[model samples]
Target: MSEKQQRLVLSIIEFLNQSIADGTVKQDDREGLEVAVQCIGEAFGVDPNDESQVGRLSIKPASLSSLFDLFMKTRERMSGSTPSTSTPSPAASSSKVDKEAAEKEKEKGNKFVSAKKYNEAIEAYGRAIALNPSNAVYYSNRAAAHSFNNDHPSAIIDAQKALEVDSKFVKAYNRLGCVFDRIQVESLSNLSWRI
Candidate 1:
């Protein structure tokens, strides 16, 4: 592609990244994002159908999801309402305040996790859970800490609690599946040794 065309494609990619970061588009709108990228590629005389080029055009998952995504996803996991990609609700200001506090605690917990302070991370997550008992993420995060500490039974318990609060929570399902698999593997290993 010519220099001008390359610049245009880059510009379009940047715009899309910004939209994704701002949570203006839903995480599930990957197809629409791909179409938009394809259109931009075509406008710049590039082969939009090229798989490598398409892959390069796509947003990074970590970059695509912002803190807002976490908040919305956690809320969705608990409540059945689909969070609109718009301004915060005035009617739920008080609840939002509570959520914000919980999120702050979660951030601290995340930091502790990154530092490998498993026990402290668990405590922070516990605080978040206490503040926002309805948030599935709080339970899920605490379960992760438990798993890291090799406490599979506690992890399973917390994962179950998370799913109990939010049956549609995908992360909880994945965690539960992982814990179950681990338990099965342990049981089989013990049986083989015994035999």
Candidate 2:
């Protein structure tokens, strides 16, 4: 949380803290998000008790996402030939995507998953990823759909992609576990047959 890292990291901390406090985060994910927010809060200089200040920093979660969107576009502009290591691939960078639209596609994917339409869920998640290649959640959710469809290889790939985009994402790890669990079961069944 150095001032040098203030603008971007601070926005992330604010969004994550709000996501946890509002109870909008999934139950399984709350603990991890809380730990991250707590760690960042410790390094943050803002005093929760200070009331003398006439104003305080506040950023909407959507705004935080938009900040990333803006940065990606700016980075694309500054380096026209090749994307930096932190930037998305050239194919993904060429398109201007709306963050909120990507979120909507994710929601649609979730609905499709809940309905047991794994194919539809995968498609929706694919659209989300195409719109926002930087979002780990989209890849993680697509991994879920792929696993549900019994496409273990695709699930593994998507889960790995999710981790690549956001290393701290717990859901991507869970998605990988889902794929591995199936593989383990198959291996054990084969062993039993040989015995």
Candidate 3:
């Protein structure tokens, strides 16, 4: 990692440590924190569990202070505690892409779908949605997986959610129409059987 990148990872670790010490992070938040730590570890090419690697980062105190300041400012902006007047930095733009860890979960869902493991695919897609609710593709993929599982209601809901996220998501509309048609056919079949 470059010096700046190293400092950013270190700053995140420091923030985690401080939050833990202050008991600001609840037990429910631990899983999210763990994911953040794992991402940081991956970015820095270091094992978060290994204290020795942290020492090896050779982060100076001055750098840590500056990083912490930036971290706090970013946090405030994210929390809407401060208005974001300035344009985002390049690092910030890259970080936004990095935050889409949901992409990994979505890929897993796709693998499950390809294997015809509809239930597993739904579960993986659900996790992906939980991680990034605004991702229209995740919802659209999940909707298809739900249809494969013979879960028309869930498929409809997911497709609708995808449309809600991105109105121009044509695939979601197509999926939704398919699910509705299936439901209609099932209803007609049931009516004939009742006759």
Q: Kindly indicate the candidate among 1 and 2 with the higher lDDT.
A: 2
Task: Name the regions of candidate 2 deviating beyond 4 angstroms.
Answer: 1-97, 189-195
TM-score of each: 0.46, 0.49, 0.46
Best-to-worst order by lDDT is 3, 2, 1
Instruction: In candidate 2, list every pair of residues with a backbone clash.
Output: none
Q: Tell me the number of clashing residue pairs for each predicted model.
A: 0, 0, 0
Model 1 lDDT tens row, 28-92: 99668967877876777655345454344332221223323444555664676644543332232
Candidate achieving the largest TM-score: 2
lDDT of 1: 0.67
Span of 10 residues, lowest total lDDT, candidate 1: 58-67
Compared with the true structure, model 3 gives a TM-score of 0.46
Q: Model 3, residue 57: what's the lDDT?
A: 45
Over the full model, what C-alpha lDDT does candidate 3 score relative to the true structure? Answer: 0.69
Q: In terms of TM-score, which candidate is stronger, 2 or 3?
A: 2
lDDT of each: 0.67, 0.68, 0.69
Cα-based lDDT at residue 76, candidate 1: 68
lDDT of 2 by residue, 1-195 (tens): 444354345567767866877888998999998777667756766432343210223332124665464346334544543334444432445244466788899999999999999999999999888788888899999999998897877887687677667666778878877776775465445446444
